[model samples]
Target: MKGKLAAAMRNLGLCVALAGLTACASGPMDVSGTTPGPLSIASEGSFFIGGHDVHSDTLSTVPNYATSGTVTVGQVYVSYQVPTHARPLSLTLIHGCCLTGKTWETTPDGRMGWDEYFVRHGFPTYVIDQADRGRSATDIETINAVKEGKAPVTALPALFAASHEAAWAIFRFGPQYPQRFPGEQFPLDSQSGLWQQMVPDWIASLPTPNPTVPALSQLAAKLRNTVLISHSQAGIYPFQAAALSPNGIAAIVALEPAECPSATGDLTPYTKIPILVLFGDYIDQSPRWAPRLNACRAFADAAVRAGGHVQLVLLPDVGIHGNTHMMMQDRNSLDVANWVLHWIDTHVTAAAS
Candidate 1:
């Protein structure tokens, strides 16, 4: 009877585990209600690359470029427009957690957008859908390996995706840390523990590669003269990957990325590269946004201290409507995009001279 009871308990546990897995597998909702408007490029004239016009108005003609077979988990979908006449400047934009590559484009309202901005400027823009989010395979076993003390198979990518600042805080602070919650001294560590427990199975389910070094080396080879543009939680991957590269990246544009744990090691490798950070002050109005902004500030400070060329743009008080985290979809996003393009142009010129 005892053996039978044990067997029943095991089955029950398995059922619960499967249910939890199913929950985590669910992706984010499509918040984009209306298609964005036509992209407007500020280039001197029309240019062509890979048979596509860099400043085309027709969105349907935009080529869907795939960067696959290089990474193990997902087929990276890149929407590209290469300028035929100009030297190709690659801008890879990485989305935040739960959000897809579509988040970088126009919203359902059709008022705000990004596609036209890059294409118009003669820059080839590529937006990435991180593994397990969009068309990427989710390896539950791999995640489990990390929680079990086994080194994860994919180093930089996994670290960026799975490692949250809140989790690291819990590991450092313990239970009483929450007594200071939401204010200065508030227990960020406690929140991290809560997030970990909330998604423990998902954390434990990630894969660990038998040989991480070679995997990273292969990833580096896949990326050439690329400028990494990351948003929110997704910042971890670009930062980590750029650090691993010998020449590093051309530049990085981080839009309100989550904070990095102190344990994550030095980010000084990217010191020579330009790092542009765009933060939304109004994000703090929502309870969900406060922690993320705090984390972003912390990470920005660290990157600057490490000698990275850091530029922090704090959004002004534009009233209740301004706090949205999806600033890329805002009409004013053009200002930010122009700034980024100018920076890239300057960098490219400097490299040539």
Candidate 2:
């Protein structure tokens, strides 16, 4: 078929483009919101930040278990890719509760995720696993000690894992499981992919604001001109980071945040940096989400009153519909990403000058 032949030719072209990484590093980027182009990657690597080592209760002589009676925990892991001639601002993405950096990765239908999308658009991209999640290691000694009766049962860290049934409601798929909102964009058939991303969240044990907040500040300082993009439970980190240290932070993009910085808190931290609070559809019908939306609205209003650059947008108002909490993994994820990219270009880059 003609379509199949065209597809094969385009695939061949992409391979050719990828092979030209260093040679065409400054090639024109694709901002048209279609399949990205100039697939050149100049550098790609990962690192860990924040956290500290804790003394382990049991010291073992086993080769793999050997340590100086200390184990490293609470460090946040970051994977970064810098395209040749990357834009001035770098994007740092953090995931929600029960998720990892994987939230910004390939969609359930195997479509391109935001990480690769931004890189193709000529911006350095960094994906983070919040402290104690995924590649960001956590302390197991407390759990081990509790099980061994060496530590009191109260010492067991509070870990919360969402059931698929609960996620149905939490993610706003519908009033409950086995149901979906009308015109929903989430890929129903590939739900197993979503479940695969859900992990045990041990946030209750972590310090308030989470170690990732300070680590995010450190990363922002390192990356310089960084735009933080967070979702769900991890949403408040950027605001906290900005308060902790506003240097090097260019902007904040929060997607369906669980909570916003209190309206009563010092609003001076956000006075310069642009902030966007985005939400998907059906919040009016969601008992939990409605209140959250109201709270975010209040914070945005307060931030604006405090002379901060804050704006709130509901997807439906912008004609993007049927998105659940995990908008990055939705069927039209690239469209969503393109919109956010446009915001960065307009607000951060333009405002800088």
Candidate 3:
């Protein structure tokens, strides 16, 4: 009976599998080669998951239909592509605080993004817009209330929108706006493209840990044997998700996370998975990022001592340098992505074999 119940639960989780007919084709990526082979995809689609209805007080003066419950907030948007020859593990890419899943779509200078590269490499790639961010719907009940005078000024949600100047320091583009760290791999000529991707972050209004963390856990079950690849603000979600539900999570690749799980936190979930925590260059220079790197190293050490499979890779140590906080979008983005793919093949796939 217990086994049957588990099977039913798994089936229920997978019921939301890719609802796609969007065509895709790419041969496995060859970073070293001059060209990539033709691509082929068996399925590709997009869908939303894990949202709760946020019914606002029926206020007058708004559009007639909107005066009714108004919105379904917190549901996450996911788009996926499954290759013709899929691998044993699928990948789910999560964007950071201000950006959307478009982070993985293309480089600012118009290079192939990691999403396509991974999909072409035979891992079904899934990318998500976190709850109340990016393509995900926002909870505008408060916005409606304020405009209608139904709520006080103080009742307004504090939304955070990052300016390009602030993003310069935050994303490690340079010491300041309009400056460049020598050899910085960020494509400076197309920086306006990066700013275009920024949007207002609704983190202040969303629940702690956000709906996206739980949604990630659910996605793991749906994708089955998945690797959760996260960056910057999303660095911790995969760990948090794995903590909640370890089943179906095969590995984790965290790229320059804002913070790593505490070295003292419960680490049982990590013992069962292969984990990679990677950081880019310029840590010692920036007081902000240096601590984060230290924290991850401490966490990695603790996880390793506890018999968990964890590796913390510093980019410069591997001879790849000049990466900023946004390493995945750097000039050497594909180089970084290819290195990760190689790591997956070596650690995850080879171990499974």
Best by lDDT: 2
RMSD of 3: 9.7
Model 1: ten consecutive residues of lowest lDDT: 47-56
**Ten contiguous residues minimizing lDDT sum, candidate 3:** 9-18
The best-first sequence of candidates by TM-score reads 2, 3, 1
Winner on lDDT (2 vs 3): 2
Quote the lDDT for 151 in model 1: 46
Which pairs of residues collide in model 3?
25-39, 25-40, 26-39, 26-40, 27-39
lDDT of model 3 at position 77: 98
lDDT of every predicted structure (CA atoms): 0.47, 0.84, 0.83
Q: Write the per-residue lDDT of candidate 2 for residues 112-230, one digit (tens) a residue.
A: 88898888776789999999999998777777676667789998899999999999888988879978989878887999999988999999998876899999999999987889999
lDDT at position 163, candidate 2: 97
- Alpha-carbon error at 55 in model 1, in Å? 45
1 against 3, candidate with superior TM-score: 3
- lDDT, residue 315, candidate 3: 90
Q: How many backbone clashes does candidate 1 have?
A: 26
